[model samples]
Structures are given as C-alpha cells and as structure tokens.
Target chain A: MSTTLEPTDRTRIRRGRNRAVADRTELHALLADALVAHLGVTVGDHPVVLPTAFAVDADGPDEGGTLYVHGSVGARWLQEAGDATVCVTVTELDGLVAGRSAFHHSMNYRSAVVIGRARVVTDPAERQHALDLIVDHMIPGRSATLRPSTRKELAATAVLAVPLHEASMKARAGGPVDEPEDVAAGIWGGHLPLTRVVGAPVVDHQTPAEVAVPDDVRARALHRA
Target chain B: MSTTLEPTDRTRIRRGRNRAVADRTELHALLADALVAHLGVTVGDHPVVLPTAFAVDADGPDEGGTLYVHGSVGARWLQEAGDATVCVTVTELDGLVAGRSAFHHSMNYRSAVVIGRARVVTDPAERQHALDLIVDHMIPGRSATLRPSTRKELAATAVLAVPLHEASMKARAGGPVDEPEDVAAGIWGGHLPLTRVVGAPVVDHQTPAEVAVPDDVRARALHRA
Candidate 1:
C-alpha cells in the first residue's frame, strides 16, 4: 500500500515557491529523520512555541501516521493544548544558498508542518506504547534497554496525539540559483551544506565502570558522523 | 556597555526546573550561536509557527538587542503580525540524554524565548540596514559582495522588529541525571552530543570556473568541519 498525504484546507501551501517536497514518501522520511519539533499553541491571546521531542509512526495503522508529543503535567502550554488545535513544525537547516544579490540569498532546508487538534492519550496501554515509540525514535532499540515508566511517572506526564491528516513537507536543496545578470557580476555564489553530527558519549560519573555504552547508542553516534 | 536581558512577567519561566541559564551574559551567548528561530504568532484564532532566519543586534541602540525577521509581503502571518505580540524561540539541541529508565530520558539544549510585541519597520534606511544584518548574520561579510536590494524588492518584503528586553535563555548541558535506583540497575546510560557542521561549497553548474569561493565562505565551512 502506498502511503500518501491527503492535503486538506489547512495543509495547502499558499506560497507556491515554498512548496518543494509534495510526495508522501519523501515527506514521511523527512519527519522520521527529525529529532525534535516546534509545537505552537495559543494561550489566551498570545502564542507560545516550544522545542519538544516527538515521534511519528509511519508504518502504523493510521493512513498518514500520527505525531506523538509529551510534556510535564505542569507545563502551561500543555494545559492550554488540552484537546485544542495545535501546529507542530520540524525544520532541518541543510545549507546556506548565497546568491550574487542581497535579495536572493536563502537557506536550503527540509521542513514539515502538521496542523490538527491534539487529543490527549488517556488509555494507559496506548500511552505506554506511545512512550516507547518516542524513546525508540530518539535511539533505535533504546526502549528495550530501559526500565518501563512507573505509574506515578506516567501520571505526571501528558501526551498528546495529533493525526497527520493535515500535514505537508517542503524542502530546498542544491546550489544557488542566481539571476543571469548577477551570475555575470563575478561574485562567488553557491551553497554550503550544513550537517548535524553526533560526538562521543559521556558516561555518567556515578555509574560503575562495568556499564559500557550500549550497541544502539554507539551505533547512532557513529552513524551520524 | 553591558547588553543584558531583563526578565518580565511573560518571559519569566514559571516552571523553575525549566530555568536552566539565568545569567544574562551566558544567555546572550547562547542566542548568538543559533542560526534559525521559530516564530509564533496568532492568525485569527489559531497559532502558527514558522522557522525563519533572524538577526540580533547586540551592539546596537537596543539595550538587550533587537531581533530582526523578514518575510514575504504576501504571507498571511506577516500581514496579521502588524505591531502584534509574538514569541520568538531559538533552540540548539546539544545532545540526547538517555537515562537508565524511560521516564527520565531528556535532551541537552540551549534555547532562548523572547515574548513581546513586534513593530513593522517603516523607515526605508532602517529596513535596508536590517536586511543587510540578516544576510551578514547568516554568512559574515556576505552582504558587501551582493548587490543592494532594488525598490521593488524592498517593497515586497516585510520586516518586523522585536526588542529582546522581555527574553530569557534556558539551557541544559552535560550527561543524563538518572536516579540512584535506576543507576544501580546497571543499564548503560549517558549523553550523545550533537554538533552542526558545514560542508564544502558546491558552485553553480552554470557559473564559470574562474569564480573562486570567497574567503569568508571557505573559512566558515572549514571552521564548522
């Protein structure tokens, strides 16, 4: 079965030039690769945006997959977002596109935007599964290495589930596209790609020396490099 | 002259645990290191967040510095954000902290949150200067090589200025803070640091071979590597 995103009224790209990646497979891959998401929700009249860890199950039963996000029970945003409409955005800065003119300079990036009303995950079983997905999303096979969340810990956390029905991913890549006149001006212009890498893991000071770095952690850190 | 941010009612972090970097000097440094910012503004009743390029003027007349953000004139968010309150957040994810238990897993990040009303920059000269600052902010000395914006181009852009007076920077560094009980379980737990690096510039295929890469571009790519 081919997984494709059905664009809704809110998902349609109003700015024609900003639409880069429209294929569902490519958009899903971009969302899966992102480690964090910026969640936006209104509190009273003002809007607050937070950088948060999130997970999306691409191969799940849901047609377009579902985005999972969690926060402290005491968080004001969390309180305001109870069954409220929200916008979750994930952006990866890929490169800097330097054009020969000041107005043409731009950045190459892959960004996904999801708009939906988040429903609080209340079922204990589903909540546990969602938590596992989040942990594994950060580090593959990480959920198996750690102990399960306690009842008290689960009660202190608030997880929101937003279906990926209204979502779109836009991307820009490759070199600078300067105008013909600017290109002939002889000013050097191109693109500098930026990459995100992982460094060596630092073990906890209190942990015993026998506790070695797990295969999952070591593999992810090395894979990024 | 010290450029320190003053915390206000809206910017003051209510959640004490989330307040990581309270010192203004350290917070200012964290903001300077970020490349992109997430802007949150209300469109009608819904909140929309956009990942955008921004510039901060630390040495300028503004006390805590001013954040300059520009967008297309046709954008709905830009049209609705005329002298309205907004939130600008810049986050740099430093590392992933894997704890011995699922509940304690967290990320090490440096984030700055600025909450205030943004004013539309109407002055032509100030707007041009802001545009240059944004270009040079992405790549140092980049604005001088590029041709200045034309009258039409200037008219097509909407620049907003938000003073950094009501802002706060919060950061979390180092390894995972696992509980003693979980640590005794012998699970491998630590933090994997993430770094952003820049790759070699790829010149446009249509450009002539004689157009060598500028010193600033070469230095930036090498420094990131």
Candidate 2:
C-alpha cells in the first residue's frame, strides 16, 4: 500500500482543501478509530445513507485494502449495493471550536470518504476472517471468547468489501480561526475537547451468577478511560 | 406536525424492522442529541456521503418540520444538493452488546434517516434563523453572545433544508438477544454503555487573560456529564 492517499477524480477535496490530508496512514487511523461508517448507495433514483458497523483490514484482498461492512442477507440496500458503486464515509468528532464570531465557530473532526465498487465476499475463508475482524474491531479479543458462528448464522449475514484505493481524508484541529478584529475584542475563544467514554459493563440478565466479566471487556473500559 | 413519523416509500424500514421507531418525538430527540449528520447525494452516477454539522427546527416552514444543514456556498456537493433528492442520517452509538455467541453480538444505537428534496434557504429571515440554529445547536445560547453575521458571511454560507415529512428512526438498546442455547451455556453476555464526554474548555491563546470561559460553554460540559 502506498504511504500517501491517491485521490481519484471523485475523491479529490474540492471544498475546504486546506483541511485535506494526503497521508494514507491518517485515513487508516481515522477508520480504525471510528466505530461506525455511513454507507451510501443509490436506491432507484434517490440516494440512501445508513449507519453500519465497519472494520478495516490493511492487507486484505482489495486494491489498496478492504473496508468491510456487514448486514443481513435480506437487507435490500445491501443487496443493491453489491457490484454497484458506493460511497463509505467515516467521521470522528474531536472537539467544538468556539470562535469569537459565530461564522468562525466550527467542529474539529477527522473524516474520510472512500468511493469504490462494492464486492460481496463470497470466499468462505476470507468471509470468516472479515467477520472476526468486525467483532474484534468493536472489542479486542471478543470473537475468540465467543462460540463459533453456526452455518445458519453465517448464511444470514452478508459482508460487503470496498477497496481503499480511491480515498481522501480531511481533518481540522485546535482553536477556531477567528478574525483578527474578533480576537482583539477579548472574547473568550477556544475549544471543548470531546472524548468517547466507555462505561462499566453490565452483566446480562441471562448470565449465570458464577460467570465473571471477561478481561478483554474490562480492558476496553479502562483503555478508553 | 403529526406525532408519528411518516415513512414514504423510500424512508420505510425494511431490514431490522423490529428496531424501527414510529414516534416523531424520538426522531426529534435523536436529531437534537446528534451533532453531526451524514448527507448522501447522488453526484453524476455514484452516490457520495459526507459529514456536516446539522440542526433541526421543529416548527419551521416545511411539511412536518425542517432539518437544516449548512456548508460553504462554494461547496460543489451543497450546490448540487439544491432541489435534488438527498438523504440525511444522524446516529448515536449507545452501547456495545456482547452476546454469548459471535452471531448475536451487536451495537446499541439510535439512527434516523430522512429522505427528501433539499431546498436552499432563500429568504433572508429564515436563512439567518437557520444559521443561528446551527450555531446554537453546537453550543446552546452561543449565537446570542457572538456578533451578528455580516452580509459577506451570510453570502458565503449556504443552508439547505430538508422537510421531516419522510423520515424513519431505528434504535436498539440494552443487552444482545442471544439464542436460548447460548444463554443456557452460562457464557458472560451483557453490554458496555457508551457516553459522549465533554472535557474542560481550553482557552484560546489569543484570548485575553481577563476573558473567562463563558457560562454556556461550562454548562454544555456539565449537561453532557
């Protein structure tokens, strides 16, 4: 994989060009950090966007890499997305930039957009690996502790892969760019940094009293802290 | 405005219909809580999804209400979005559902998708109001403190409104629904609740020492807590 992102005609940043990041590593980092991705596909004559859990594999079988998003086989949008052109976007809100003027007030965020043709993973071995990655992406070491997916469960799920070749990332950080006049007016301006807080795990009602919270789950809570 | 969400042919939830929310109040609540919305628009032949800050007006001059998203007038997508069919989605991840088996693992989230024709706000009064709502949406009572937007600023920004007439919301909460056999096996299964944490406001370097962090900003952090 190339170290820099190769922006295609559609992936090029036309607006807010100053915020664009050419580094491919940043795209991977943003995708890894984001838990959900919004998948866009044309349904009939209109466009539809839906949120889904996503996982990325840097060395997967795709042009640059593979971005995996799974849904039920019965999902109409997912079925239509197969072999069709799609756009996947992942965004992480970092902070709220408070400027002296409302015009300058903005959000500090890292966002990536990838445009490609969706490929349904038909290979059993690769499909299984992608499923594991999706599980572990949410909670590290999670899939290993759970029972294997049954054939019926596997058949019900459908995984779609989009190549990471034509991708572009843009990010904004730090304080807002307020006008010099506003800054000179002594108005308070900065940012309120936001972070995702993972709370304590609540035991399922069906779990036996003897079963304890696993190490991986506990670690996830602590790591976020 | 009706109390229930009016799902059109495109906005109706097909897959995971169990999670679909019919209450319009729930859609309003989710839109109020979410800071970013992913907008999907078909540009040329492919669909493109991008994240933008959004605000909702419950009694705006639209069919049910109005959902507002703003961007630079120079933005190509925003320009193309006018009078075009667009999809706006807002999602909030509530928790991670850990099931006894890999097949049952899922995420608890509230997501709303609105499909409608985008109308660029032309009236100066409504456009100004939308801009203020966009600002106050980020930090409550923020626009009141900031200086009024100049004509140049107003000209540079473009606000698009999508009626809330055709919208659908889906939410999943609590623990995962594991199979009876998996639950009987005594495997630990539950959920890790996720919350958005707003950290201390970092003062801009350019701000005078006399200028203190505003009360609204401090209140925002406390409210999120």
Candidate 3:
C-alpha cells in the first residue's frame, strides 16, 4: 500500500466551490459504497452511457488507486468502444437539498468522474478476482459464500479495471445559496433534505428453506431502514 | 401537445444487441421516477459528463411525452450548450442480476438517453411551470408549499427542457443468462438485489412545530420498511 500519485489539477479540477470529496480514499469509499455507475463513451460521434454494476478490485487498494470491474461482453457499446477514452461516473444521492428560490434549489449528492482509457480485461486470475470484487462490492462478504467461476465462464467474459488515481469529484450539500437580493425577497428558503435508506429485506422467492440470512448480509441490511 | 417536428435519427439511435430496450412507456416511467440525470457532453476532445438533479414534465401519462427540466445560468454548460445537441441520461438501478456465466452478469436497470437540442426555457410562464415541475418531481407537494420565484431570480436563471418523446430506453433484468452449454457448470450465480429507501426522518433543527409533516411528507417516513 504505497502512496503513488499526488492529486494535481487542484486549480482546474479541484472540487471548485462545492463540498464534494476529492480525496482518493474518500473517493474509493464512495465507489465502494455505490452499486452501479454510468459509463460514458463516444460511440462514433454520439456519446453513449450505460448503467453498469461495477466493483473495485480488492487486491489493488494500495497507492490510493481504484480498479472498477463490470461485465457482460454482449454490449454493443464495448464492441464499438475498443480501447477508447471513457468517463465512468458514480453518484450517491444522500437527499434533496431543497431551497426557497428556484435558483437556489439543489440536491445533496456525492459523485465521482473517472476519466481513463478502457481496456477489456483478459487475464484469467485477474478476471476471476475482479468478478469476486464485483460480488463483494455489492454484499461485502458474500463473495466467499458463492461458488467460483469455471474456466469456460472466465473465457467468455470481459471485465475492465481502470486505475482512478486521476479523477474529479463534484458535490452539492446543505440547504441553498441565496444571494443578498434573494434574502430580502421574504422567501423562506431552506433545505428539504432527501435521504435513501434500506428497506426490510425481501427474501428471494427461490431461496431454499434451510438458507438463512448470513451475517454479512444482515450487516449490510442494518445500515438501511 | 401537438407532435413537434422530431427527426427519426433523433429518436432511434443505434442499438445494443443484448441490451436494447424498445419500449416507449418503460422509458417514460424511468424518466419520471428518476430524480437526477447525468448530462454527457464533450469538452474539447475529452468527454466530460456532469450529474445534475433533473425533473421531467410529462405532458400527460408516462408515454404521452415529457421534457427534462434543470436549472443554472452563467454555468459554462448551460451557457455554451444553448440548444446544442446533448445527451441526457436517466437511470434507475432496480436490483443486481447476477449471472451464471461471466458474460451474462448484469443489473436490473432501466436507462433512457435523449439526444437533442436542449432549448433554454424562455417563456416566463413556462419557466415557472418548469421550476414548479422540477420541485414537484422531487417532492410531489413541494411546489404549492413554497413561494413562487421572483423576477430577479428568474432573470439570472436558465432551465433546459429536453423532449423525452424522442428518447430511447434500454434495460436488462431477471436471473442470470445461462448458456446452455454451461448450464451444468454448477456456478451458483444469481441476481443479488439492491435498492435505496428512506431512513429515519431527521427533523430540520429549525423546523417549526406549527408546521407538522403533512400526509405527503409523513407518508414517505411511514412508508413500508
């Protein structure tokens, strides 16, 4: 776990005036918490973005780096985008930051945009590991409980790992930004926050009778409503 | 609303062989329920996407047609992207669909991408309606609860409404896509559902006791846990 790159572009790509996190660890944590990301790539002259369930590789957590892993090779998007530069973005919607004035209206959100070259993963061991990370990223400790992939399954799959040492984050939290002119307008502008919580776990109808919720699954569930 | 002059190419973009979603109503529902969207555009040659809170104004039902509404003036994007061809994507991560094979792994996701000229809303009445729609989108009863926007606030702000009638929706759901040949592989792969919901309500520190949580607001708190 050696420190590799220091975040530059503070002047240009820094959080700017917003309160979104930019630290690699914080960014990685946010990526770890998110279940999916919107991956943007240019398809011909058109920009195409796909919703994907991605995972951060557990084996590569050193140096403030993040490796996002996602699958399904049949996507026409990956076919069109061989090794193109892409932007993978993940957002955690904490709540809506409602303000009085329509101008001051906003949301409380945390988002990260990773810009890098996209390559289809080929290594067997790494691909398998990436798949495990994808599983564990969803439910922290379920990867071990699931059966491992077969050789043929590995061969037919495609996973990409992008190092996120260079990226940017933008966020808007708190109530609102009311100008001096707006304050006197007598509008009771403030924050109406929106939050997302976990609901009571609905057991999959197909689960067998003997299988109960595992400790890891219950741990993740405790955080939600 | 009369059907506006919409080009064919504007509506039907390229297709994703395994991921293409041809349903029009499905796309509209996804857009209506989504509270935010990622606005993807090119900055110079690099693809830069900004995730902003957005709301869609459905002229009628989900399929009757809708328009995306978002605010910000003086922002480089809203200013530079006056009626320029842009891609606005809305997505809802319903659940995680684990696959038996690595290639079949995917998510239960519904995403809509609209490629068109995002016109800056100019009419005062329409702008107010758009603003109200944006608020109403986040909280169904918020627009009526808050005071209306002032003339000065309206003068400085801009809202872009992108037509949703000409948009395309793509989705993937259900259990793993198991290849017949690999059905005997014994990889216990299946979907792991994920969702976000409302947690315990934290009253605003300054909230007045006089104004209690209305049925609309309290209903979210008492929603099924």
Candidate 4:
C-alpha cells in the first residue's frame, strides 16, 4: 500500500495545475474502481479512442500488475495494432465544482493513464486467467459460479496484456477555490458530489422463474446503492 | 428526432459487432448525458488520451453541432495538438451483463465517438460563450448566478471547437444474451444496472454559514439521484 509514483518520460503531467493525487496506491485504487477504459490506438496518423471492457490482475494490495483488454478477433483495431504502443485511460468523475466566477469552474475526478506496448496473450493458461479476472473484476465472486469457456469460444476472443510500469494517476477533489475577491462577493460556491449506485438486477426473460438469483449477483446489486 | 446516422469515411464502425445503436439522435443523447470525455491527441508519433471536461452546444433536438473543450493555456496536449485530427469519445457504462458462460459476458454502455479536427477558438465573444456553455453544461442555470469571467481569466483559458458532423454512437443494454446450451445449464445470467447519484453539496470552509445553497444546486442535487 506504500507504493510510490515514479514519473516516466511519457507519463509525466506537464500542466501541473490542480493535479491533486499522483501516488501509485491511488492509481491502483482508481483502476480497481473503474470497470471500463478508453483505449487509444493509432489509426493511420490520427488517434482513435474506443470504450472497452478491461481488467487488471490482482497481484498485490489493490495493485493490478498488468491490464488485460479483450475484444473480438475480428475487431479491426485489435487486428491492426500488433505490438503497438497504446494508452489505456480510466476516469471517474466524482463531483462538479462550482466556483463564484465562471472561469474557475472545474470537476472533481480521478484518472489513471497507462502508457505501454500491448502484446497479445497467446498462452492458453494466461488467457484463461485473464478472462476469469475480467469477469471477477466487474462482479466479485461471480466468475466462480459461471461455466468455463469452450475452446472454440476462446479462439474467437483476442486478449491483450499491457504492463503497468509506465503509468500515472491524477485526481482532484474537495470544494471550489474561488478568488479572494469572488469569495468576498458572496456568490454561492460549493461542490455537488456524484456517486455510482448499483440498481436491482434484471433477470433475463428466457430464464426459468424457478431459478433463484445468486448471492454474488444480489451482493453487487445492493453494493454502494 | 428521426435523424439517421451517416457513416463517414472516418466515423464508420468497422467491426459491426454488438453495436446496438447508430442513430444520430441516440448519439446526441449519449453525448449530452456524459460530462467527461477522453480526448485522443498525438505527441510526435505516439497517441495519448487525456480525460478532460467538455460541453456540446445545443442547436437541434439533443443534437449539438460542435464539441467544445477548454483547458489551461499551458497544457501541453492542447499546445502540441495544433489543428491536428483528434478523436473525442464520451461513454456511459449502464450495466454489467453476466452470462452463464464466460465467453458471452459483456457490458452495457452508451458511447459516442467524434472524429474531426479541432481549431482553437480565438474570437473573444465566441470564447466567452463557450466558457459559459461549459459551466451551464455541468450545472444548469449555473452561469447566470456566477460572475462573468475577467479578461485575464479568459486569456488564460484556451477553447477548442470540433465539428460533430463526423460522429457515431454505439450502445448495448438489457440482460446478457447467452447461447441455448449455456442457458440450459441453469447458471445465473442477468445484468446489474449502474446509475449515477448526486450527493449533498459540500460548501467551501471559508464561506460564511449564512450563504445559502442556490436553488439550481439543490435542484440538480435531487435530480437523477
């Protein structure tokens, strides 16, 4: 839990204005909390960002060493991006900061940026582990209840693993910081916090009514609600 | 509100799998619902994605013709990416679809992808309007209550506008779609809906207790909570 953040050549934050959190522990926590990531890959000379499901392997205390992103084998981006340097970013918008003046308005957010080369996970054992980790990452303990993947189904999926060594986290929280004059002007200034709630589970219509909802599904449904 | 999607040369979905949405109205709704965007910009030959606050100008029915992004003038990504083709993506994760088998497990999300070139907004009046649009975008009726931006504050901020003509939306919702054999296995299958809640406001400590929270703030606090 005492991991430090070492800024790499590309992971450094150049703006440095209102960047509140940059520690490795905080980065790991943010990565664990977010379920989806916006992955950036080069399409010719321009950059394209796609929202995809991602999971980080649990190796340390809230620290996932490698990030695993999966897609269909027919996905053009995955097929074209062979061992290419890419970026994976996960962001959580916690609140909206309202300042006394229009210019100072900002958001309270936690973001993690990982910059590295992604290699296709070819080994069957590691690929299986990555798939399970992804399922459990979204819903803890849900993977154990599900059936394993068939060889044909596994062949249709493509898994990519990116090392988390060159990564950085940045965050901002708390109330608005208005200028001294604006504060004295007595304009209302505060922050409206935002939280994510998991709603009740909706069972599939095709499922039989006799089957009861599993504990893992119910637990996550009520968690942070 | 019946605008169909026009597949541009750049914004077309090449992988055509599980892309449940393509209507322009749906794309506009997703863009309006999301507050933060992952902006992809190039630095030398590599792509970097940064989480930033953005606002879409409302012109048609939930159709914002231009995407406006503002940041500090000193930000490196904004500076280096002068008139470069950029992709701005906004995504909302609605649910986690858990199938009976690991292979069919997926996520329910609404994502909008815009591919275009961003130009720095230089007109003073347009820049002022863009700043106010961003403030009101985060919180409705917020800009009218706060004081206007000073000349110095306006100068420090750089606003970029990217046309939203070349854009597309993709979404997936409802329960998991499992195979027939997997459905017969009787393993649990459902979706856990994720929602965003607005928590109570936290006022600045330096502010006097007599200053009351504005109605706009209180209204949004209870909205969609």
Please compute DockQ, using alpha carbons, for every candidate against the native two-chain complex.
0.73, 0.84, 0.31, 0.76
- Taking the tens digit of each residue's C-alpha lDDT, what string does model 4 give over A1-225? 337666677988777535846577787788888988999988887998999888887461123378898998988778755599888889988999988888778889989888888888898988888888888888889778877788899999999888777787888889887899988877778899999988898899877888888898888887762
Among incorrect, acceptable, medium and high, the docking class of model 3 is acceptable
Report the lDDT tens digits of candidate 3 across residue range A73-169.
6656676555777778888887654454556666777888877767677767677777877777666676776556777667556777666655667
Q: Please write out the lDDT profile of model 2 over residues A1-225, one tens digit for every residue.
A: 999999999999998899999999889989888899999999999899999998999999999999999999999989999999999999999999888998999999999999999999999988899999999999999888887899999999999999999999999999989999988888899999998989999998888899899998888777662
Instruction: Kindly list the per-residue Cα lDDT of model 1 for residues B69-131, writing each as its tens digit.
Output: 999989888877778889999999899988888888888898888887888889898898889
| Poorest 10 consecutive residues by lDDT, candidate 1 chain B | B15-24
User: What is candidate 3's lDDT per residue for B97-205, written digit by digit as tens?
Assistant: 5444445545677787776666777778877887788777766677787657778778877888776656767677666666665545444444545565544444443
Alpha carbon lDDT at B139, candidate 2:
95
User: Candidate 2: deviation at residue A161, Å?
Assistant: 0.4
Give residue B114's error in model 4 in angstroms: 0.5
In the range B1-225, model 4's lDDT, one tens digit per residue, is 237766577788867545746677787788778889999998777789999888887451123377889998998889866599999999998998878888888888888888888888888887887888888888888888876778899889998888777787788889888899888877668898999988988888867889999888888788863
TM-score of chain B of 3: 0.84
TM-scores of the candidates in the order shown: 0.95, 0.99, 0.81, 0.95
Q: Which stretches of candidate 3 lie over 4 Å from their true place?
A: A1-16, A58-64, A177-225, B1-21, B60-66, B98-105, B172-193, B199-225
What are the per-residue Cα lDDT tens digits for candidate 2 across B35-152? 9999999999999999999889999999989999999999989988999999999999999888888788899999999999999999999999999999899999999988999999
Top DockQ prediction, candidate number: 2
How are the candidates ranked when ordered by lDDT, highest leading?
2, 4, 1, 3
